[model samples]
Target: MKKSTLALISLLIVLCLLFVWAQNKILNYRTWFRVEEKILMISDRPEITKIAAMGFDGLVADLLWIRGIQYFGGNFSTLDKPEKRSGMMNLLRNLVGLDPHFLAAYQFGGFIINESIKDHEQAIDFLLDGADNNPLTEYPSAWRLPFDAGFIAFYQLKDHDVAKELFLQSIYGKKFAAVSVENAEGVKDDDSPEWLIDGDPFSSTRFDTSDGVFSLNLHDERQVGRVTVQQDSKRPKSYQLSYAADASMAAWQTLESVTNPGFYFHDFEPALKAHAFRFDQFKIQAEEDEEFSIAEVKIFGPRNPATPSYVERMAYEMDRAAGRFKAALDQYMRYYDEAVKKGDQVSADLSLQKLFDIYTNKCIEILQETAELYLQEKGSLPTAQMFELIQEGYLSRIIQQKITEEPGFVEDVAPVLMPTGNVWEILTTWDQKDPHLLITYTNDLGEEDWYITSRTRLIAEQKGVAEKLQQFVNKYKEEKGTLPENLSDLLNEPWFGATRIYEDPMGGEFFINRETGQVEARNPKY
Candidate 1:
């Protein structure tokens, strides 16, 4: 063989060896990436890492995302212990840093770490970062990232003002977005109710300024958006809505006037310092035989419903963090109700779910506390008085109205208590065992302009089942000198004025645990 040919073959062999060595090195680094601590150490400087990726930024981000999912999914069983998921958040942040448009990383990672690991601050940071980095052009009509951040601010952080601000940013681009009509608080005047209508049909006083005046009594200075009037008579007449900065002032400026009036809808720019408003006049009045009646009057404006003052936001957060549940409950419930009344379902639902969570979690907490006290004081499980104590001590009046009695209050702010066996039972049984159950319930009816606000309906039938079961359990203990052997024992002969107990709403058998004296809905179809 020629010497030149032999040298060429040797060079080729050397090149092949070098290629194999480089491949092995790459594989080693890939393996190291799977190790969370190593990922954390390497990902400490994301910009530097991105630079090192040699312009394959998206590819690098994808690889990191895969690793993050593996880490999250593999060890999710240990989610309760956040320490076990130490490097999960770092992995996600690094993933997003490489490719800011990797929205899935922001969404899943932000929610997972925040909800499961209880690192809400980091989760909120991820979401806010995504909101800032990914604009509407790239992620068109995508408001979720900012929305997620807003949720964390309101629900977890309990900062209402921050939540409101973030929510507005999500809906409207941060700069362009002012609080729109959907979010603005409803302006209601206490005296405005009495002034809405006056006098008998024959007297012709409904539209007469001397007899009665329709007005809005704003609690504070707010921006007025629109006013709607439904006249009882089909006859066309000119109607003018007037506004005044002060309720006491006689000077009135006409906000809107409609000549063709069947269902009058007048949209106008809000007064910057407007306070009180009233009906100016009704033109072309009907004869004494024809009575002018106004059926409904709806005034909409920018009342700033969910935007709490700094003091209120701080108080709520402090109370929630310190575990002052009743105070926290009151604050949350009021916010939820107010938001609903103002037609801000987004804020209302968010706050409503938080209220339920607080209520359920707090109830379980107090149950445990009361149970512990009973165990210490009387020993064993509690009796009738113990149940009574649970009702009175822990649970508040839970104000619910079947029929709304308050005048000028059109919306019903009742709790939308969905039928579940006993919420407390669900909490105790499935505290963190099932994460999906913790998801907030939405308005199944529809999304917009709900006459009855989207609230969890507390069904009477299901409530009876829970309460009856509790009574039966205590009764069994009293009569038999121990807990009943089975639920059938309590079902025997007119115990609840019937042979069998009430069926579970989910078409399951009502289950009673003899050991714990707790009731549950078991054997659900799905």
Candidate 2:
């Protein structure tokens, strides 16, 4: 063999050995790294992290997101530790900070913080930050963040006021207008009820009888909130407020009863939707041949241009969320059947329990809303029978009416309550003015189980009452050419007639803001 050929072969052999050694070293390093647990260390300052990203924030965010998922999964059992939770949150913040449009990361981080870490305030703040970062005009899916925040506030924190605000934010635009009024029961004459809604609070509608009725009609079904009634000298002794969805005036649901009525203003939380409202059972303190009159009847509701599309969007998002859960439930049921066929009892049990959870949650969501309406109307939680009445058809009718009246609702079948064997039990004590519903059901374990649903009714009753009082103050000033020395002076007037002028629902005192001459609550609920 030639010496040159031998030298070339030796060189080739050396090169092959070097390549094999390098490959083995690389494989060993990867194996060692995989075995060792890695810690997720991130900068506390998002701005610093964003600066370091060098316009590759999106790519960095993606990589960090994957690392976050792995870290969360691996340390799932230890997430209860405050340090671990903090680390996870920091990583999430940095990831989102680098890429503000990383909506999935925001949502996932919120869920983990809420469900695993049980840090409600942080979760809310994080989710709201996501909502603020993504404007609804630019990213329509941004609504989900606020909706999720509302869910956390309502369900976890039990802060209905905050939840209501968040829910409103999620829905975006909701503008109210004055609802139209007409004479429904009173004698038809020139002094018709139509004059009550003529924009002039002084334009009077005279009724000859002690008892009279007026109807409020809206162009479209709207979520009616504020209703202000101004009396012309002779106020009714009392009145009943009710609503109906049709012109027939059948199936009217009573909203409220005012025992001592004068000038009244009420703002309903979680406003009720209907086509018409009725001021019935108006009993005036009348002497013989004396007539009472109503100066104005103002009903405020969401009837503006933006309301229709916003409302539709809200309903659609809610239904979409429900649909996702339903799809998951259907899949679980299928898996349960498969598990049963395979005789995998444990898997079947797990699937069945999951199905029950999803079903119960969805039912509670619907029931909670209906129960709230009942509470708003009756001023108390529904009894079993009352709840049954609502479940049977009343709620369905209200929903159907709303859907039918909406401009773009064209579904063949209106959503209705599905029949379930679960029983609703109302639990309350003598001291518990606001009670809750306990739903009893047989779970997958074939045992009696219950889920409790409760919520606080955050109504600004005093706010409305104070505004009405301020109106009275303005009237008193207009009449006497001076403000009353005290609220007591106005109560002494014959038109008011010793009727309790203002009582705060949350145990606050109504006081006059002497500077602005506006009535204010000492401890405002809102």
Candidate 3:
């Protein structure tokens, strides 16, 4: 080989080594600078950073996200400082602003804001922004933003109304079609019934009297399975719903006679096929001075063929939360009972209060679910009287009576009122003006304690009743030398009354399980 060629090759190798050394020095300098500064070295303003990216927003966002994660980890303990927290949040906002599709950044940033920075309002706002930017249709995971926002609003911020809206958004996500009202029966001046079908839940239509009626013309016969009614403060106390095949109003089939109808959504079973529907016999006033007002009305066609995965997930989460609360309630009740048996007055008192709180939570959860169901079935909100009947386990009986009272009622095929298996006597008072439910509980000291319901609580009274029944059953078995054939056999005993065993708050018979000697109900309400 020629000497000139060999020398050139050696020079090229030397130059490559020099470049590698320079790159390493530059990386070391960057690390040293970051450590010394101990601050984010990026523009806080999202717009400024986006402009600086110059069409490389996505790449810039990725780099910022990595930097955010590192910064958050490093300054996590010091996030209590306002400046540090604000800096972290600014970085997250900039990252998402640059790449709105950055799902992980939004979720993680929400966590940082809520858990680390302890800024619940900002966390909710950030998450809702994420939900807005990432449409669920385009990105299925976007539902998590609203779901998490609802969780924070409910559990952390204690804002149930906001939480409910967020949860509904997460579940439904604007899937329903708007219904139009072709005609109205009772139009009073400016308050027209067209507002009822205007697709705005907040706008209301007022009627002059209780005898007003609203009619709908579907143009073409369609099968509708659900009817949602949103009412203002002046709501109907009772109403009749019917459907007909034609506009002639002859041979109208009665759907239901709803009393104390709460506002929201109502669902019908066995979808009705008709071109015309009528909402009449509206007994709107409990007092002579009151007026009737309805916000919106919706008639839904058949549901979608497939349920969204997010909806399924929301249901699962609701059930899981209920289960967790139920378990906690059961444990606390056990503690209360043990304390009582041991004659620990102080402990018993504490446990009793705790039991009230826990049960109130559970009742709130059940009550919310019940209200939703009632709105679907009865097309109204539950009143104090309705809850009183439910607590006395007389709701089903009253419903049965109403059905039988109707003309041409059949005896054999009359629908049976099934036991809900729920033994919790939720003695609640609902006010239409207020969105909250007020629950009254009398403690052992004979003082009435009032509680505002929120989410989940325990059913201590139900468990107490079951426990008492089980004790009686055990006594009967011990005396008779075998399990009784039926719970009715215990009724013959002096202590066992027929009313105690037969009358259930949830409208079911309580029976003794012969095999386990355990007290069980005929049907499970939940």
Candidate 4:
């Protein structure tokens, strides 16, 4: 009887779950159907499953509009027409309007439409529509679509200040309460003289922007010179450490004696503020002692990508958010003015506040959200670029893995710049013969050099070097009576003394084997 009761209870539970699932399925199907209907209203007006078949060229209209894909010429030679790309933008916007949370579509659509329309102003319609749709995730991808579109405004569109402002604004979405506490003064030894917090916090002895580029303060008294700036306080992601020599000059020199990322000290009598260097960059440190004299060590500034100060990056992000908001607001205000003039009072007033509130809330939300993201993504603070890449599906582990795969090669080939368009341009080159000349760009800075395949080709090009060696061997035999066993003996000869058998540029050395000449260099693997 007990078994029977248990079986009956199990059946009831199963039936109940099935009923609930069925109800949920019906509700979801109904909701999706409505959305589907809305989508059809925009594109497939007749709501038919099948459209006229397209052959050879897929969607003739799309072919004409797209940029890279050919539309005409009956062949693949011509670039894709821009008109098809515009149609794609419209299609993507319609797709996004139906389901706003389709994040990849925004990226894909942005890539094509941004280029197709050529009018960046109109191209944003699809992406903005996508940005407004929320699919509901902890990190709402909808928030990111506008950013991808905004790049069109900045880069492809060539409205630089606008692009920059948008990029800066994109880094922010959540708010971060930038918390900071003033440094506590260390207790001095009784034997030492008392000291006061001297000069402008940002003056010669100590330069504290307080926003975390760097803090430089000098302590002085007697012959003992010790300048203690903030050490390990934090480092910006892409900053260089240096100090100014004076106010009038606009240059800063690298602190050579310093070993760590954020501290410096020197043997000068009393480390005072450098009153000379004022600007940011300086030449490499030479052996000159006075040039490296100690005064103050500045942590990298806000502009420095390496700046790790939470307070500073947060502030920079906020300032950028505010700037973008102001501009957007101004545009909104203009629209509002026109609406009011046209007697559309409801829209004029509502639109005005809506724009302001969006910008204001955005400013607050992003500032707060950044601090946490920085700690989560970087463990400390993030650089401007790091902040941008991390939020966009990029993982730090992948970046580290890529960096590690090349061994020290990543550092050796770290590019100063890469090409970008609406998307970005990547040049993939393969060189099996001459590696030295196989560099991506032929013209290079004086410092940049090739180490791998290019080096091997350079070795291959060295010709007369071997011939020169053979000639020397013959001459040695004639002069020294018999061939010398080693090159040292031949060095005494006039020709040997004056002419070299090795190529310095190619790093090739010639050796004689059985009266024959041989040229060799270190292989690429080495």
Candidate 5:
């Protein structure tokens, strides 16, 4: 060969070597990614906190940030400089996203991280992305996102409408996704005894993974794109078609010819709900794409249930509005309950949860009656007392009606201290004539409202604030050998710099009496 031809051949050889080296590096990086995941799992295995902490490093820090964002917006302020802004969220998201099986990334990164930091918008976005990206058993986690979101928004943000809507979406999504609607072991949805998923379409109670046999769930009426199949080697690749019925999940069924590789859905079906399908199994032969690698097949199909039904839509709306309200009630109720119990004297009917229901029920009654009331009178246009009186009225009705409808509904319910399991049983309210109590919250206008509010609002508002306050109370006792005489005295201490105010949701104020170290609500009903 000529000199020119020799040099050209050498150059080709060099290029081929470079390509091989680059490919190996990419493969090795993927292997490390898997290794890092294992490290993370070991780090977080609850039983190994101390051990995990020992091995924890920057990789663990990154994992925590990802987890933290879904936890409480990751409290990046606690993470130091650059890690705070590194789009760690997106990086964390990608890590959890592509795997789809890493449920923790979705729950911890998507929900816990977001909820912890109160990053509502991002939380929703991450969840939605997870919903679309998650394959196979995504429904449970996906449904939880909306359900949990609704709960958080309703309970924490005091936004009931959004909460209501999110719950509805969760319900509908579960149905369309073909998820089972059976009560998840210990879930307590107020309306679940009434709410249910509709649709079914399979007759064979028993099925097998035989190659010629195909199974499909036509839960939705959407065009299919591809499937990721997990198979038993003995059976090998099989071409199959599937469809859903009534937008229910338990209704997956097989339809047509089986194809190799991922499916490319043809003859699009656009009826109702989203569709999920796949081949029977994946075999080693299929992995090599010899005949066609197919393992744990999940075919991408058409979107089903394109629009929310009127009733479903209504439920969603209710959840949205109630979510924030419920969330606030939940947070405050816990804190306040702790404070009440600290004295070893319990507050009756004072749980934040009960207060929320009581207050909302009262609001409903007021709206129905078309009446306006005031702060000092028996009833007010919108005061804590007015809400309580109305709530009491509703309670009486609920009790009386239950006697007529389901007389035994409240029979098994026992009077418990605080944090009762059933929402209805959570609180045992103060007697109507009981003294008012102090509670506080940051109001809509961003001002702290503190007052001697009704037992209902007071109980709910104090739920979370007590933890921060308890530390102060404990410190005062530790330093002075007794409790602080006043809020001002606590403020003079080093740790009490910024927390001068203790406000409840309706804005009740806590006062410390000067004469005794004993801390009593200058008012007691809270």
Candidate 6:
């Protein structure tokens, strides 16, 4: 081989080595910059940052976000630090400003702002801004931004009115649809009767005077069974029920006569075969008032497919009451899935509440029962093994089994914000006195997650303690033939085998008000 060719090959090897060394030096320099303990101070002006990014604004914002997460994760500093939290918030705000369509950024950032920073106000602001800017075209039909805003309002701020309004807007968006009325434009004021289709029995529309006409238009004709009238206060002296084919004709067919008022069920003879009906004219003859108020007017036929079968709901309640937690949960799950599949948000919400009640209320009863049995048999407070046994065999089993089932179980467990129309106005009132329901929504790569609220867990523990205390009171009354003045009396009784009342699992003191027979927890942090 020629010496010149050998030298050329050696020179090629040298060039390759030089390239490798240069690449390693560049990587080492970048790593040094990445690890340096530099203070992170975010720009307050998002607009300025956007302008500086030029055409690659979104890409720049995303790169910054990745860097922020890495930095936040690397630093083991306390999240409670004001500066750290402020810097993170500022970073998130800028990222959102650059690309409002970045959903994951909003979700994760809101969670951190609320949980780590504990700045619920700023978190809510972030959610509202995202909701206003990113339309439904970019997200799910049930946009989560408003839903998150509602969560902050109710869970953190305890402002139900604001939460309710936010929830309604999230569900219905801008346009509202009528639930009962088919074509509202066709109905002329007082001339047309208010149609009450298949809805809640308790819901009703007022009928002005006893001597007034109420027209009815059935969606389909069927074998008529009975029409029930629910009055507001006073029952009319006498009322007549009639049916007609159309509004143009005057001759009405009498269904039945209701002499006494209150909830009058008028049954039709031979089952009238007509599509339209009317109150035809009636009188109250009340002493003081000239007009009578009717809460609801329900028209029941042979079989109305719209009406929910109470048999299933009642069966669930019965099974739950009988300590059949697994069966009851299964029943509730069935109804919940059915309602959600049909897009009946009202029924879905109702079934979801029932499921919650069983979990937080009925399940606690079983826990208390287990505790009572352990005390009776072992003559002491329950051990950790006993508690674990109850939890595994009962509580966890029921929930885990359902969660492991079909694909849509997770979504069904998490109630989506859907339009409820008239039901919204009726059910949206703030019931501050009742125990609040908290729902947390999260998505990881399109997989939804639902969890039992912390408040529910706390309430369940309290209810367990309260129920056991009630049993003690009842036993005292049985032995002494009278209610005790205080819980100390039960503890003092020797024959009662009274040990000590169980301490609240969620750090708090339970007290019974002797005057009211009411048990409540004091300083309940949960």
- Output the number of the TM-score-best candidate: 3
lDDT of 5 by residue, 356-452 (tens): 4534443333233322222334433333333453364543444445447753233222221123433233223433333233334467699865434
Segments in model 6 whose C-alpha atoms lie over 4 Å from true places: 1-42, 75-77, 159-169, 174-526
- Residue pairs with colliding backbones in model 1 are 185-303, 189-217, 416-455, 416-456, 416-457, 417-456, 417-457, 417-458
On residues 208-306, what C-alpha lDDT tens digit does candidate 6 reach at each position?
Answer: 553345555664443454465655443344666667654443567776666544445454444556565565345576667655445556554332222
Tell me the tens digit of each residue's lDDT in model 2 across 1-526: 9999999999999999999999999987654443312245556777988888888988889988998889878666656566576678778888998888888998998988988888899899999999889865467767678778878987798775466556656655222344666656664377767777775767787765545787877766666655667665522356788888765656789989874333555556557677787887766665645555677776654322322233322332332244445334434655577679879887778776666545545445555566656656766555532455346554555455546685322221121123231233222211234433444446669886544443222233445677778888998999899888888888777776556656654445777778888877777322
The per-residue C-alpha lDDT of model 2 at residue 191 equals 71
> In what order do the candidates fall by TM-score, top score first?
3, 1, 6, 2, 5, 4
Report the lDDT tens digits of candidate 3 across residue range 1-526.
9999999999999999999999999987654443412255667788998889999998988888888888877767667566576677778888999999888888998888888888899999999899889765567667778878888987898775566557656744432344446446666777767777776768787765545777777766776655666565523366777888875656678878875433534444456677767777766656556667777776765433233434423332342354434334433455567568778777667656655555455445445555555656766555533454365344445344535674322211121111233332343312112223435446659886544343222233456667887888889888889888887778789867565354443334677776777887666331
Model 4 lowest lDDT segment of ten:
421-430
Q: Could you give candidate 4's per-residue lDDT for residues 1-526 as a string of tens digits?
A: 6999999999999999999999999987654332222212235421221133223223432332332232211212211334333334445544444434556656666655555445466657666655445321233434456456556765566564455434433433211112111221222223110111221222222122222222232221111122333222212112244545554334667644333222222323233345321112212222432111112332211121221223222222332344444334434555566567779787677665555344334322332344345457766533322333335533333334545784432322222111221111111111112221222212236453322223343443555465566677777777767766765556677667654334434443444454443323343221
Measured against the true structure, the TM-scores of the candidates, in listed sequence, are 0.34, 0.32, 0.44, 0.24, 0.29, 0.34
Q: Tell me the lDDT of model 5 at 12.
A: 100
Q: Alpha-carbon error at 200 in model 5, in Å?
A: 20
Question: In what order do the candidates fall by lDDT, top score first?
Answer: 2, 3, 6, 1, 5, 4
User: How many backbone clashes does every candidate have?
Assistant: 8, 0, 18, 47, 119, 3
lDDT of 1 by residue, 1-526 (tens): 9999999999999999999999999987754444545534555677888888899999888888777777777656555353456566566767888888877788987788787787788778778888888764356444678777877887888876567556645533343112211111222332223323232112222543334345555645655544546554445567666777774646778766766434454544332456666664555455654434555554544323233333234434544665645445656666677677779887778776667666556434434555555555655544322344335433222221112443211121112221242323322322333211111123447542111101132233455677778787788787778876667777673555656666664335777776688776677421
**Global local distance difference test of model 2:** 0.63
Model 5 CA lDDT for position 246: 43
Comparing candidate 3 with candidate 6, which one achieves the higher TM-score?
3
lDDT of candidate 4 vs native? 0.39
Candidate 1 wrongly placed segments (more than 4 Å)? 1-35, 40-43, 75-89, 177-526
User: Each candidate: what lDDT?
Assistant: 0.55, 0.63, 0.63, 0.39, 0.43, 0.56
Q: Is candidate 4 or candidate 5 better by lDDT?
A: 5
Clashes of 2: 0
- Pick out the ten consecutive residues of candidate 2 with the lowest summed lDDT: 408-417
